[model samples]
Target: MIDHSIDRDPARPDVGHGHFRVDEKRWDSTFFGRQIGSLSWTELPADRKAGRTELGRIAELSDAAGYSLVECHVGMTDFTLISLLEDIGFRVVDSRVRFLTRWTLADVPVTTPLDGAIRWAVPSDRDRIVELTHEGFTDNDKFCSRFKNPDYFSAGDTRRYFEAWIDSTAFEADAASAVLEIDNEVRGYFIYQVRGEYEELPVVKGILTAVAPNSRGANGHLAMQAFLYHRLGLSDWFLDNTTQLTNTPVIRNHIRSSKRLDEIVLTLYRRPAA
Candidate 1:
């Protein structure tokens, strides 16, 4: 079940605007002060007509609740829902590519020496981690596009999400984090899950990895990832990374390292609540 705490404040009848179980397994949530509603689910409706109709209902409800924005990702197989969403008001924002591999320690490459020391993060490093993360991502194509289009994306909201995640939690639970230090200063960081959500499959996933602003143009991000992957000794894992189609440098790095493309998720956004 999805968390319902986000729905308690300024409560409305469980439907106005906040996290809610839209249906059994399907859920929706409000973010950025309940101005944006996002529909997500563990298993979307299988039948095309049913899927489209269900999403349409969610959109209608969000509109009535004064939501200025709504967004969701429909898998390629659910193109019908995409069309249905477009028919109302949603437009494509960006596409996310999921890469998967049965990664082994042997796959790590030895190249230019990473001039930094990687170590476990401590409570004191929380503020630095958040700052470096924002700096690292500010120039990224994805963040740039989102910053330019506030109606569809909230860059501030994105930053806050990462800030909360990096604020000095113990690093050995479901998720783990590490820092790259150069000359005794934090220059880069990486976050990954130690185990997959599904125990049966057990896939390690690298979630957020980044380096500080001045460190751009260097291979710090890639090097940090390689070091973490080697240290963790991941046997199989997946990394969901996305770059704007025009961001050639990062795209090249992704293609060179990825073993397989799992699926491309199209992000659709609707503005003005209609």
Candidate 2:
């Protein structure tokens, strides 16, 4: 089943006006009365007290629903709420560095050759995408369980999301999406968006990128770099990809590749039922 917990609530005006939306379906889960699992709030106002109250309510709901973990992204410079979350038992789960490599008109690098072929994905690629996603995430037990289990998102629901992404005109126009295929089999994919208008400080926001476990080493990285070369050229631009602190390989790869600039830490909170 697709979780609609984080979607906007039409009945509540406050929910739609802000950049944040709470997941009501998740709220109804057993985590509501004692704990919360993976909650995200974005574009929250700067009012500290109000923010705490709202978060507290969400926590209460999550506790009742039997959730034991929650996660969110906050502005790196926003210390107010970050501190509050820490005080409430949320521990810093990971720190991620945001890096940028720019590309200019004259500096575009030729696409690197891949053992696999890269191509624009169509609706037909949906099943393959879902399969790759499952295989790619299985290394992380928590993520794999959350995504693979029928309680979270069924195979059909997963297909719907992939289909939507494959068919999105916006994704096509941005040129930030593609699938990697090897020997007529889909191996991986990536999705990103260009952020900012100023050429001097443009950012390429990565949405998702994953490669199947069975794919050769660096296939994922090569595909990602090729996409960057194609879209942003060879000039420097800011890009950030976040993963759990436990994911040491991902962090090391970003650092080793000089693809990260600075790391920002965020907490994941949980309150198990009594």
Q: Best by TM-score, which number?
A: 1
TM-score for model 2?
A: 0.57
**Candidates' C-alpha lDDT:** 0.60, 0.55
What is candidate 1's lDDT per residue for 1-274, written digit by digit as tens? Answer: 1132323333442332222222211122332454655656655566756656665666667666666666667688766667767866788876666666555567668433247666766777777877876766643544544433656446666665556545523264666677778888888777877544442445666666777767655677666667666766456554445445546676677679655666767777776542
Q: Which candidate should be chosen as best, given lDDT against the real structure?
A: 1
Off by over 4 Å in 2: 1-97, 100-108, 138-175, 196-200, 218-220, 232-236, 271-273
TM-score against truth, every candidate: 0.70, 0.57
Question: What tens-digit string does per-residue lDDT give for candidate 2 at 118-205?
Answer: 7766667766766665556533454522333453345664444544444443245554667777789877877666656444666666
Instruction: Looking at model 2, report the run of 10 residues with the lowest lDDT sum.
Output: 12-21
Model 1 poorest 10 in a row by lDDT: 17-26
> Residue 45 in candidate 1 has what lDDT?
60
Judged by whole-model lDDT over C-alpha atoms, candidate 2 comes out at 0.55
